[model samples]
Target: MKKSSIIVAFIILLISVGWILSGQIPKKIEEEETDSSLNNITDNKIELVKVRTEKSVSKKFNKLINIQGQTKANRMISISSETLGRIIMINEKKGEKIEKGDLLFKISQDELKIRIDENKARLSSARSQIDERKSKLNEFEIQFNSEKNLFDKGLSSKSKFANAKANLDSARSNLDTAKSNLALVKSELDLINNELEKTIINAPFDGIMTTGHMEIGEFVQPGSVLANFIELDPILAIGYVSEKELKSFSLGSNAFITTSLNDKIKGEISYISPIAEEGTRTFRIEITILNKNFLIKDGLTTTIEIQGRQVLAHKISPSILSLMDNGEIGIKIVNKESIVEFFPIDVISDTNQGMWISGIPDTSDIIVVGQEYATIGKKVDQKLIN
Candidate 1:
């Protein structure tokens, strides 16, 4: 009786366990079916990111290389004194415009004039002495010739012939001395005249006197700075170009310049350095522009724009620019299949309206709005923009 009760209790425990498992298995299956239905509905209702796009039409653009530059005078020189003298007159003051051959300064010509006059008088005396010496030499030569003829015929004494020859030699020596003295006097006169010319300093070229003008009573020696002279006509616009862009530049190319004062002007490329600068590795360039009115000043900052090769580019607002996973700057566009695509671009130039860029299709639907939310290679709902 005890063994029968133990077997019956064990069978009752197994039956309770099986019934509990059977009820739990149906409930689990119903929950899984409900989850499957929800998943299907969610997958079918998936929506694409909506983006605002504009059809960008590429146009022919003249690519430009903009360079920061400065205006420089074509020629800058420090006018200096060439002779020692007291400044007697200042023809031009500081900031005065002058022309070539215009008198700028005048030194005391009184002393120079006196010296020149003295030299002239000495020259006259030398000439008179030369003439007298020539006459004496001619007389001595005739006498010596007569004496030699007589001596040769045994009609003149040896002592007389020798004396005549000696006198002729002395006269010739005196004549040579007089000629040398005359040359010396003439040279002295020439030197004095040169000094007189230096007393009146004239402008070497048409320019403006910037500084270094001395008072009338001030003394100046040779090599003293007289004035700062600069030529403003045909001024130079100086700038540097990178080594990579140097090949694109050529002599006589047209360039547009804008000064710090907002002066717009045109120029031509005049010079290009063959060797690059040491530290910057850039070549110096000079553009020549006419400054007839002298409006442009030296050292004024300027912007130079040089035209490059023509290329097809699209103009887009800077806000639409995007970046790729690799950190490359690009723009996002929708292809024919409505898939978002990233295109790497080269910025050709920028203006007030937008930036011009290249390296894209001739016509593309660029996602201007909602580009940040759009993923590359994913379909997007594109909305056309005006």
Candidate 2:
């Protein structure tokens, strides 16, 4: 009975092992079939990159130069005294607005009037001497004529006639000397008047006085700066341009100016430096902007927009720019063959809408989306975005 029981138990264990093996064999076959199908799909499939494109339109755009500069007064000058004297009166103060020929300061008229009066007296004395010499010359001429008539008629000695002629010549010389002295005295009087005029200083032009508060009794010399003056109307906008950008500029070109305070003004190119700056190697450009109200101050930082020639350009978002393998910045486009191409661009100007760029085809289809996946000179599957 024990032997029969052992054989039956062994048959039951063998049936369980056969059932487990039958289930695992089918599963292994299914896994192998799945792996084979995946390999077939991978081998013969083409990789396609999806990208969005836009049609570029050719349009005329203004080429512009965006630069920074500073404002300057149209005319700046240091007013200096032309003569030496002591300050007796102060007519203007610093920061005062003055008109042309306005008195700025007064120098002490030390002995100026006395000198002029002395010259006048000397002129009077010379005039009286001139009249007396002329009367004596007339008397000598009459006597000489009488002596000459006597000598010609052989009625008088040659010595007597010669003496009379010498007297007349001396009188004429005295009269000429008197006239010269009169002229000299007159010139002296004129000099004194000119010096008197120099005692008072006046403004050269219509401007604001930036300096001068000379107190009374301050001694000043020739060429001593008495005040600072500036003309603010029609202010100057000065900037520098590089060598490459020099060709785009010309005198009288129109420009737009903006101040740091968001003030926009219109201007024109006034002066272009003939020589380059020594340190920067750049040419200086000056623009004239009307400031009739004198609202603009000098030395304030400014932004200048100088318009250049009109050229064909494309305006696009800045994100569309890409970098090539050579580290060049550009945009990617689709050629006529629907293949990817690269074009380098120059940024002309930036606006609120977009960046204006040059150096692309007049008309092109540019990749807008999935541009990272697009390779230059490769076929692409372009997808347009609405």
Candidate 3:
């Protein structure tokens, strides 16, 4: 009985210690939960994002279109022969400059000359025949008049007068036939002369002879190319313009060009095609530039710049550009409420200073730094660049 009573007292003491420890543990855990709640609240508070921005200024933009082209001779042609003959003389050589009417080729004309001589002889003979017929007609008329007077005065027989009249009529008819024959001969002579002239070919215009297709003693036929001639005093620079840029150009528009040979040429837009090319949908354009020295040759690669009208634009650094989630290029700006905003821009051109752009506001605070960190329509803490 004494041992049992001692065990009960120990159990009671253990219960009392347990109750005290449970009460203190609950209070300590409550304090820790409160502190954790306070930390989470602090973390959830929104913090302002800092960014670097610059106020955009508007400037007049001089639009310029850059295109590549090639230089061409103002006039290029292949001179051909009009008659068939052996080439006997070449007055101008290849690469020689010549003026209009300068004799370029001479075909063998011995046979042609003989034909002309024959025609001339025939013409002279025809003329002599016509004169002889006219003289016979005059003599017959005189005889007819004398016969009629004699017959009226009873000095001649009727048969004789009738014979005289028949002779005069026959003589007049012969003269008419002779005159017709003479006209035919003259026409034939003209044709022969024209053929003779064709034997000597002359330059059609002022140009440089680019080639000599026939050598001495070579036989050439009609339509055979004798040489190539090109006029280069006013060089043509040919190029194409995009459909979107077509409206920006017109005939007589001033342009500047640079060639592969480092030649700077000033020119005017001489021609603009009314129709677009089928494949590229581009319009053709030609610029006329003076090449008096003939230094600019054909087929040289060239770059041209055509100046367009002036427009209002903003200049911004290339780094300031960004892409939206929708894949549009734009710039981020700070609005009047100091909120991040996006404005799409069209890049007009690139310069040493920056990119000249359009389609943005005339005045804007462009976010140069931390643009990616800010969301559109969200407020930001902007740091202005001095």
Candidate 4:
């Protein structure tokens, strides 16, 4: 019986050892499961990313004005003749530069020269006649004085004195008439000379002449078209603005213009038409474009843009616009529970900077990147992008 008891004890001891070993098996399995779950979490973290983002708010809405326009030279003109005469010499050819008062044509001066010479001869003869009349008047004056002295001395008759005085007066009047006649002839000659000179045409301003109306010896009438000329160095851009856009445009506003002909011009508002067109309800605005290079030609189609509207917005790359679930147009935002939140924004203006949003806090930090991946109220780790 003692031996039987000893065998039972040995069996119990073996079973105890087996039980202890069996207990370790569950712990090992639990440890392996924990390690596997940790690995899985790490791998999932790579699949999703936190997109950095920013927030935008609206300040004040700015209005934009758009307009269309054409270009023209600042000064353009057609020359004309002042009198009817034959063109003697043509100084300027087509496409020639001319200064102000530059002679463009001359007329035949044969008649004018003869008229000038005749006036000179008449003036000389009038001077000689005036000298003779003056001498006669002087002699008559002396005779009248002597006759007056004789009458005062009672040695001459009153009739004789009166006759001497009358003679002096006549001579004086004749001399005056001759001098007046000479002056009139001289003035007539001057007027004719001016009229003759008017046969020659001259440039009224510095410009380029496009055409010469008459050749040498061609007779032109007064007010005939001589040539087409345009003043250089400054040009004008004529544009029309809608009535709504005219409010933003005023004198001195900066503007830019680009033409289809590969010319870029910039200028400021030079004029704004006071009256609006009754039909189109549009107003005219002008910009004086500088032509320093002399490369810009007239009548080029152009585009104009105005700056400084005082807009408040966020600068996002154009790619940031996205679609939201339930089809509501909104951007992803952050929530209290490490979750994503989305809200619709009132879009004021979409600009090169970004979308100007209303209904968002001015200080709200928004998610800019990875907005589509995270759902509303879903847990996430957010990173900031300023």
Candidate 5:
């Protein structure tokens, strides 16, 4: 009975110890679970923020601007004579449409014709002399051959054979001289004919002569003003562009205009001078304007406006266009999180309504109202005002 009581006491002590350890185990597990739940909640708070945006592919814009210009002629050239002679026959009258190789004026026979005739006679005489020399040389050669055979056969003397040989050599030398003289005379005749041909002046281009300075029996030399020829259908409108606005235009830029008397006229930049004019410091530009209806005229006053590309669709109060934080002028926009981002855009051109700019997107939703209050990366709700 004493041993069983001792065993029962030990068992009671072990049960109390186990019950206390079990209570601490449940508390430790609950504390670990609470700490893990707090950690999870803290980790979940650290990652990504919410962003909301709407996106859609828009239709491509075909932007057209109104540019002003004038109609101009393509090209104009004056016809001039290459030879110095009097005008004998005026083939085409003034205001006549002529093509290439058309005859204009013809001159009568002058000293040039006489010189050509003389050269031709000289050439014919020289040819006749050459023919005579050839015949004479042939006769001398036959005689020389006969004498040489006789001398070889000891029937003719060496003196007679030498005389025949000398006569043949003389004929041959005369023939060569005649040929050279004929060649020189032929060349002279060709040059005279060329000069005679040049006496007839022809139209150098396809156009109408505005004014004719000479008539029949008029003596004109090279470089003399013969006629003022100009292209009839189109005319030239000359103008100068400012040096500051040099970069505002380009070759082949769009230009348009309308006259009070004429309809709408369209033109493109045809020429831009590489060097600026010294007096005006302005670059000279030529635009090829068309005048098909025969409306445009020379020396007509015209207004020209070179068109450039447009930029920026954001609307702003006209007051803020020139506003500056310090001294630099710029506009501010909002980032993804409604943060303000200020950037400078050189105002290349501006109208009474709005400003055109570069270095900006084609379309931007700018923060015009709260831009002064916003900072970069500051999150705020954006009001859709477009």
Candidate 6:
């Protein structure tokens, strides 16, 4: 009777186990079906690269050529003595502002004045001698005529007529000599007057004296430098342009200048070199700016910005720029079909905010974020940035 009870208990346990297995099998099948559905969904839906994009629109961008330069004076000259003399007066001090024709130095004029007076006296004497010689010539001419008439009429001898002719010839020669002497004296007087004028040295233009004046009573000779002068009313900003940039530069174009002292000024392109420099292959350019206050100084460091041709360009942050496999600089953009594309661009100009670039469509969707993950020609999921 115990054995029979055991068998019946085993059967009951097996049936219970089978019931548990049946319930687990359906649950496993349901789980497998859910997983298969998930797999199918994943396989059917294409996974794309996620990226952020910005719509860039092209506009009229005035390209600017920025060049390093320096400030220069409009004109600079070394004032020098044109004659030998002793300095008697100095009218302009170092660093003094001078006007055109203002006397800057005075040399001793006593000797020149004396020479001029002597020449004047000589001239007057020469003129008097000429007058006396003319009178004598007239007298001799009249006597010669009278003698000739007498001789012709047989009233005077041949020797008497010959003597009268000689006298007339001598008188005429004297008059010519007197006239030559008068001319010589007149020339001497003019020379003396010119030397007297040289005793005073005046400013050639409105400028500032950059050098100290010679002390009074100091001797100076011709070609001796007296002072250094510079004209600053219209200053020049001088710069150089590369060979590639020379074609776009032109005379009379507008330019902007910024000095090391942070002084900003507007100017016009006054000069562009026709030939390039021998070694540097660069052309020189000069911008003229009015400096009535004389604040701009020579040799000051400057940056010159000259406006160039207008072009359609897009302004974008430099961070978005990328490099291609061939080492070309470019930017990645999304096409209408949501495919990523790499486009090479030319940098037009740069500013504080962004860089202007060209060589792309007038309107484009540029990849702003996740550009590194973007593959060329691969479709991407783009999100427009606000």
After TM-score superposition, the amount by which residue 236's alpha carbon in candidate 3 deviates from its true location, in angstroms, is 2.2
Quote the positional error of residue 369 for candidate 2 in Å: 2.7
Which of candidates 1 and 4 is the stronger one according to lDDT? 1
Off by over 4 Å in 2: 1-51, 260-262, 381-386
**Per-residue alpha-carbon lDDT of model 1 for 88-140, expressed as tens digits?**
88765566567889888888888889898898899999999999999999999
Q: After superposition, how far is residue 168 of candidate 5 from its true place, in Å?
A: 2.2
What value of lDDT does candidate 2 attain over all alpha carbons?
A: 0.87
Residue 77 accuracy (lDDT) in model 1: 95
**Clashing residue pairs in candidate 1 (N, C-alpha, C atoms within 3 angstroms):** none
lDDT-best of 1 and 2: 1
lDDT value for model 5: 0.67
TM-score for each predicted model, relative to the true structure: 0.76, 0.80, 0.75, 0.65, 0.64, 0.81
lDDT by residue for model 2 (136-191), tens: 99999999999999999999999999999999999999999999999999998998
Count of backbone clashes for each model? 0, 0, 0, 1, 2, 0
Model 6 score (lDDT): 0.90
lDDT of 1: 0.89
- Candidate with top lDDT is 6
Task: Give the per-residue lDDT digits (tens) of candidate 4, residues 1-386.
Answer: 99999999999999999999999999999999999999999888544446665655445555344457888878998878877667778775567557788887777777777888998898899889999999998999899999999999999998998899899999999999989988988898888788877866687777677767667777778787877788765777888877666655578888887887755567888888999889888888888877765566778878876542554544334465557656767666675465776667655456776655554555555777777777677776777655
After superposing candidate 1 on the true structure, give the runs of residues whose Cα lies further than 4 Å from its correct spot: 1-58, 148-162, 240-248, 259-262, 273-284, 306-312, 332-343, 361-386
lDDT of each: 0.89, 0.87, 0.88, 0.74, 0.67, 0.90
Which residue pairs in candidate 5 have backbone atoms (N, alpha carbon, C) closer than 3 angstroms, thus clashing?
72-235, 73-235
* Distance from true location, Cα of 256 in model 1, Å: 3.6
* Tens-digit lDDT string for candidate 3 (1-386): 99999999999999999999999998999999999999998989777899999998889977778899999999998888888789989875567667889988998888878888988898899999999999999999999999999999999999999999999999999999998988988898888788789999988877788867779899998899988889887889999999887766678888898987856779999999999999999999999998877788899999999876677888888987899879999899999899998888877778898898888788889999999898899999999995
114-141, model 6: which lDDT tens digit per residue? 8888888899899999999999999999
CA shift at 153, candidate 6, in angstroms?
4.4
